[model samples]
Target: MHINPYGEDPVRLALDLINDPPGSASELGRRCAAAGLVIDVPPGAADLAETNRFLAAWLGVVDAPDETARAERLNALLAQAAAYPRLTNHAADGWHLHYRDPDRPLAAALRALISVGTALHLSGRGMHRLGRCAAAGCERPFADLSRTGRQRYCSPACANRDAVRRHRNRTAADHG
Candidate 1:
């Protein structure tokens, strides 16, 4: 089985959606496809609202204080979503397991995919894998798939900015 929904991509998709929300159902479908998720059905008005609510709730899991706390939050979410595992090959590429039924609504599918993907990621990787960017002033959350597991920022640009700021602060302290 291809685990973690292929590493950081699933969480990256979640971050992208959270950072810049889609304005319409079509936009959501487009964004999900762009993020490598195979969307079999397009979303509608209700799907959009449902997706928005789901994402907001999912953010709470990301913002949880600790691993155990995060797991509890995620488990609650999964229980609420209440999907079962099944196999699908929407794109005709190959068979893969889905935690949702084929005919489920778009929002429900997203909830299942995002929640299950998140659980797989955290359990397979590490609890510290998901967190808010450590860069000053950037509150965006990210999933770290780095080999060393020391990533604290969303991107290299943020990391570089934080590093420069730290260096300048240390130099100023020494001079003063």
Candidate 2:
């Protein structure tokens, strides 16, 4: 089945990239392809640099102090990235909406996808959906795609570690 590529996938991709960034443009391209993105052009050094810059800006949005600040930062990113939507069947998989101009570099296309997807995700879910993990000493970023919208950790390991720490602290307090 054909899913909209501009929604959760891109946001998730952004989160993955942020959490463990690609080492090079080739790695970035490989990761994006693995994430189901169709890369029509080969990624290069410029794409890597641009993608790093874009992710830094996106992290600014994720770490924004409030909804208003987040919205402002996101707006700036959208302005810099997205264009009018167009219909395309680039891979012949099926016709889909593209939020960027055709034949752009991998980095440019990724910027648009991430920006638009993040906007959709935040607005459709909640402005507070994107954030740092609440596990103490592990502040990695995550996109809260959980059904309950109460995710507080970046991964199961982090959550379990934090929970164990809390239990130990409570036990120590009781003994003391």
- Highest TM-score: give the candidate number: 2
For residues 8-61, could you state the per-residue lDDT of candidate 2 as single tens digits?
Answer: 899999988988989999999999999998997899999999999999999999
lDDT against the true structure, each candidate: 0.84, 0.91
Whose lDDT is greatest here?
2
Candidate 1 TM-score versus the reference: 0.91
Error of 1 at 67 (Å): 1.3
Q: What RMSD does model 1 have?
A: 2.0
